[model samples]
Target: MLNNKRRFSLMTTNSHSSSQKVGTINGTKVNEMHAVEAPLSGAADEAFVTSLRGRFVEGRFVYRQIFAIRSYEIGPDKTATMETLMNFLQETALNHVTSSGIGGDGFGATREMSLRKLIWVVTRIQVQVQRYSRWGDEIEIDTWVDAAGKNGMRRDWIIRDHYTKEIITRATSTWVIMNRETRRLSKIPGEVKKELVPFYLNRIAVASEEKDCEKLDKLTDDETSERIRSGLAPRWNDMDANQHVNNVKYIGWILETVPIEVLEDFNMTSMTLEFRRECRQSNLLESITIPTTRVIGESNNSINRKPHLQYTHMLRLQDDRIDVVRARTEWHFKQKLQ
Candidate 1:
């Protein structure tokens, strides 16, 4: 079992000292002063190395991590992109499993799951961004998992400014197991369930009342508002360890069909995505978007409301036209930010 008393630390490089204490985990001290000088090689460099500092908290049920926003993670607006924030959520969730002592070699798989050739796959995810973190900013993220229905798992995350402690984002997702060999959905095995039950939390980061509450509409090509982008193909780097296109890549493709005018005038406040099928590197895809004037959950009488636009998106194979993902996004006027 991990030490429940572990605390977070923000480490800095000191020119005067050879090494400095970063933090403690399971009663062992960690130092990162030398790492700053030597730097990491290969997939991650020095800049990426300094960004990740994480630990377990709340009796080890919740995982908290502090990430320094790197220059590469930010966009032209000098703020972290939606894709960057999603990547942080993914990395934190995987680290949580690794620290729990129940993880197997497979990404986030338990021992029983690895033996059974089962891997977790997300079914749906929703993210609400109240504010975007800027480059050089440090943001703290807390994530926890709970039971979803009888066999599925629900994960939630809350991101805040590390210094001000102001909430920046909230996200929630649902996942289920899939058999690796058969490529089919599977129920939570008894042994795997036993491994996870101890770490499950009853907390929710994104409230249901705050969500649209209505199901995400499955958009078809015919329903799109005359905006479509075709001939999209996955690059080699887009594939994950599981040999499928990474989920975050789908978000980029979905936005490809969105009208440039909408992208310029509005900022995406929330996005809901439903993963229906996996895409491979060999598959060619098309993106479609449907513009809608009516906001799904907003009230007409709401006070101080900013102009909002909603969009429905679809990504599918270009040849067979098989749906890979369906999504909905809500955007608010950029003037609100000004």
Candidate 2:
């Protein structure tokens, strides 16, 4: 087994060195997850329609709808930031639900799951914006999963534009269930799980990247075997078009690993994460993940992790091959972590 943390030779060449372990404990195939295919819906079918759904079991069901917007201007749109667009697209995706806000429980309460002591958490979310969405457009979102888990379940979603009937975006997600009091992952009952087994697990979400050497050099020595434990749950407001956790939801997991005080010390200026995977609907991701952390100093705010960006985050799927999604996030420092 390779060490989780590694040291590299600061050679005379133009590349930086990095050390990584070959695999993970639970057989999580990180690189094997990413990319999704829509039956190719056009940009004209997305709209706020809640009339499409099938009640699998007594309490289990599907949620579907569409957003009526078009092209979200990337870079500088005079009215949006990629971050703002990311957050907007996600929220827009989530507006379809008959439930307030988004995610499983909020949607669950509306469906009367009545697991009163349980709550839902979004572990990880990956998004691929082949093209951005625009205003004055209508989008459709489809969500469903055949079953439930003790601590989590899987959920799938798709976003289609109405006027053109083109698929704007698609994604899958993993989530876990938690005890309200203990806040620990629990196993779903057999009866409950068996009820939704019809919804087969999708392949997986995988991402590709050729991160520069600078990213490797940014990791701190102690960041070798970093594992993110828990984070704030996905709130009603955290939902997007398909009524599932949004891509920007991944950032929550990124900073959720850092203490509040530490997060406050830096302003996220630049965040570059490509989605190699998609998450399903009603899936409360557990986030039992460990990634490498890298940090660098910048003179001024140039990207999203603008001015004083202090910290950088690099997360990977502990695998023999390279990980699927290698996120490199930059945060500027307002103050050092105390």
Candidate 3:
């Protein structure tokens, strides 16, 4: 068994680590029940360290971290909500970039863009989950970067069970730098590239050969389609420290357009979202959800299995008809609690 101290060391290197542990019983250490078991030989120890520290691949330094699913993050099914996992991945990405010396208030400090005051923004993300982790589950997330367009870069992550190492989810996201004042996309600066080139990875996080990551089916103003249009304006609490609508709030608004029957009966299996523009407190947007046909087959037959549904959702400005976000969601029947 790995000692509690050594395990902690593997998960974090900084003395001022922000890692949190959950699911502790009365008078027991947080890691007591999470201790890993492996051989004590030198080779085994080295392998364990590599897995925990995450080695570089194709020049990308993969960072690994563990998260204990807290009670508040779970839904009625006692499993972590999709939004919660997204938050974890988002935070991990920020921490990774910060440690690389190119994050936070110093986003573009190395380049002239700093003079213009630029910030990195997530343009798109696709997340697929094989399983939703229950409360108290300890999961590990490994994240890295891939070469992207000259103006943007791609980041990817693989989340897994810390004990069994079963992959729980895979995600890929694209980000671009923008001038805070102008609110316009900016070119990747040479100095920024200098800091990131050493860690660029050639591999992708999820395998989607046929799907185009850049283009998502947007909600059209088709009267023939069953569309749910609702007013969506952000509240003060929905805004983040960045002075923009929190990304998680977008997910909630998108779901608001989903049919109540679907929301009550189904569990979201996967989602691919493209954030075209940012939303502010003053912006009045319309949420639109267009449900695609239910592809019923053996997989969705009620006699053989549960039903599945898919929807194409979007958030657009009510006044100018500009798209703020476009996304696709897949859901399946949720299992009843025993």
Q: Please tell me which predicted candidate would have the highest lDDT against the true structure.
A: 1
Per-residue error at 181 for model 2, in Å?
A: 1.7
Q: Against the true structure, candidate 3 has what lDDT?
A: 0.73
TM-scores for candidates 1 onward, in order: 0.82, 0.41, 0.76
Summing lDDT over every window of 10 consecutive residues in candidate 3, give the lowest-scoring window: 7-16
**Alpha-carbon error at 250 in model 3, in Å?**
0.3
**lDDT string, candidate 3, 23-79, tens digits:** 343556544343223224576666666554444333348877678799999987789
Candidate 2 local lDDT, 1-338, one digit each (tens): 01111122122222233432332225553353321222222332221112222112223344444433434532222222335445543443344233423234452321222344544444444333333454444455555542334456655555556457766454545555445456555556454354335444443322223112243233333654454443235666666533545656666565555556545454443445544433434334433233334445455422222233333454333332223234554445533321
Off by over 4 Å in 1: 1-52, 294-307, 335-338
lDDT of 1 by residue, 1-338 (tens): 01111223244555454444434545565564222223235444432343355677889898888887999998767788889998999999998898889999897888899999999999999998886788888898999999999889999999999879998899999999999888899999999999999999999887757765567676665675498889999999999877799999998898888878777766688888999998999999999988766553454422223337878888988899888998888887654543
User: What pairs collide in candidate 1?
Assistant: none
RMSD of each: 8.2, 22.6, 8.1
Candidate order (TM-score)? 1, 3, 2
| Model 3 RMSD vs true structure | 8.1
Q: Stretches of candidate 3 above 4 Å error?
A: 1-60, 104-116, 210-214, 223-229, 300-307, 335-338
Candidate 2: residue 286 Cα off by (Å): 22
